[model samples]
Target: MQKILGLFLFGIVLLTNIEAKDYEIKMLDMDKKGHTMVFDPPFLQIQPGDTITFIPTHKSHFAQSKVIPDGAEHFLSPLDQKTTFQLNQEGVYLYVCPPHQMMNMVGIIQVGKAVNMQEIRSALPKLERKAMTNKGRFLEYAKQIQE
Candidate 1:
């Protein structure tokens, strides 16, 4: 009986330690009704083990990583219906759609901490004009994480 109780408690602890979720980021057309030429939400805060599924609600849209945490892996979605990526690092991740990049279809994900903030800031200016517009927003989000 004691052994069985111990096993049950171990199972419960294992379940409690699994902290992962699937976040959705939709991609819309530039002419969409509600939101267009952008990633829905545009910004997200998640834990290190979280995953983000990028869904192209419209045609010709794909999510590609522009900047990621220093030791994190970069990702690029195929020009398909959806793409999912798991973030295992603790930092900021920036992504955009290739074809609609000029329209500023971009997004940022904050995982755990904004550790690579300086790199993200330095890389912002090199982005397109439309993407630069999001710099302030991203910086603001980063500040919140720092605090």
Candidate 2:
């Protein structure tokens, strides 16, 4: 009887885990040339009920939204150490760094779908455009993060 009860408890735990989804974002450091960039895990996709944890192993890093084409929801970590952003949408997200925009520090997030490499690649230019234009709103958002 004890063996049967243990098996049932294990089954419940497994089922609970399947229902919860989680993801991670690692902000990488500068290369030999001192260019800070966001290392691509290539693709990070999740369902609506999922979370994305942005872990910056160093200072001077945060995440922001791409406004023009994708109009992705934005979230930035204050200069206060580590931060996490839980995703609650069902659309594609394109993000970039403000200070290092010229260096092409970009990333993509696709929610409720399998990893699509081409889709992510296509969105890269939008991020570049926003970075180059130094658009008022976007840059302001970054400044807020630093503040």
Candidate 3:
């Protein structure tokens, strides 16, 4: 009976430790309604161990990391394919679609905290004109996270 109780407690512990959740962001094309080639929910906040899946609902879209936290890994998804990235660090991550970068197809992810705000801010000026337009949105989201 004691052994069974121990096993049950272990199972409960394992379940409690698994806190990761999956989030989906869809890539959409420019349209008459002024969609402007963007990622739905361009900014997201998640915890370490959570995963984000970038889905290309429209053609010719992909996700590539443009800025990442120090000591964090960068990733690029294949064009027109769905890709998943796991956030393991407590900082900010910025990504963009290569072909539509000039059109400002961008996104920001905050994992646990905005620890890499300075790094992300410094990298914004390196982006092209259209891509820089998304900077305002990113900053707004970052501010929310900090608050």
How close is every model to the real structure, measured as TM-score? 0.79, 0.59, 0.82
Window of ten residues with lowest summed lDDT in model 3? 132-141
| Runs of candidate 1 exceeding 4 Å displacement | 1-18, 30-35, 128-147
Question: CA lDDT of each candidate?
Answer: 0.78, 0.57, 0.80
User: In candidate 2, what residue range of length 10 has the lowest lDDT sum?
Assistant: 138-147
Across 24-88, the per-residue lDDT of candidate 2 in tens digits comes to 66676654445456433424656665777777765677767663223335777665246667666
Report the alpha-carbon TM-score of model 1 versus the true structure: 0.79
Error in Å for residue 122 of model 3: 1.5
- Candidate 1 lDDT by residue in tens digits, 16-112: 5686888998887743455457787678999888899998787898898989998899999999568889999999888888887776777788898
Which stretches in model 2 have alpha-carbon errors above 4 Å? 1-18, 30-36, 40-42, 67-72, 114-124, 130-147
RMSD of 3: 3.0
Off by over 4 Å in 3: 1-9, 16-18, 30-33, 128-143
Number of backbone clashes in candidate 2: 0
For model 3, what is the alpha-carbon lDDT of residue 39?
Answer: 87
